[model samples]
Target: MAATEQQHERALEIFLDERPELRIELDHLNPLLAQAKGETAAQYRAERLHEAFEAEAERLGLFAWELTLQLTAASPQDYQAQRLEVHKEVAEMAGMTWADYCQLHDL
Candidate 1:
């Protein structure tokens, strides 16, 4: 027997959740991951999954940088300012600076 539409959607969600990297692939995944009947469908799913992974990684990186900046924005004393400076330097070294990352990603 064929699976119900709800069944298909639930299965797709489970599949994507198992591979969090593919969550971004939903834009091209037809909401239900569709029925993979042949090679082309498989290839399309793979491509979409890859795109999603890249997008999500970039988003997380930007979010981390923004959070760091907000948390360090209230340094009133000299020592606090020095510590914030050190944190910013470390984040830059790790390639997590908000301005640079956003510019690079065209975001």
Candidate 2:
């Protein structure tokens, strides 16, 4: 009955299949979105890298759980549990936790 069971299996597989890690280049990131006036290509590149990283991480984190909707409408608790599990998996897959990453980058 739960979406996390068999019915969600295939979609989960496909989504995982689609999200591959990318090598990032983030030299210029701030001015583009925040300061529209002085935003140069360098900033654009950084912004793009940031956006890409966000999207890739989201997908990899099993936010694609909508694929599991065919199985059931998961409760908030189920979704939260799954999200945490997915976040952990995603962070590990990408080589760090959110905390470790933020701290490492001094973010």
Best by TM-score: 2
The collision pairs in model 1 are none
What is the TM-score (0 to 1) of candidate 1? Answer: 0.27
Q: Name the weakest run of 10 consecutive residues (lDDT summed) in model 2.
A: 20-29
Task: Write candidate 1's Cα lDDT for 1-107 as tens digits.
Answer: 12334543454454467775556544456533444444465566766654554464467663333323323344446434544565556557777976775466554
Q: Please provide, for model 2 over 61-91, each residue's C-alpha lDDT reduced to its tens digit, 9 standing for 90 to 100.
A: 5333433542233576765565456555656
Q: What is the lDDT, from 0 to 100, of the residue 34 in candidate 1? A: 42
TM-score of each: 0.27, 0.32
Model 1: weakest 10-residue lDDT segment is 62-71
The residue pairs that clash in candidate 2, if any, are 28-46
C-alpha-based local distance difference test score of model 2: 0.50
Off by over 4 Å in 1: 1-15, 18-39, 62-107
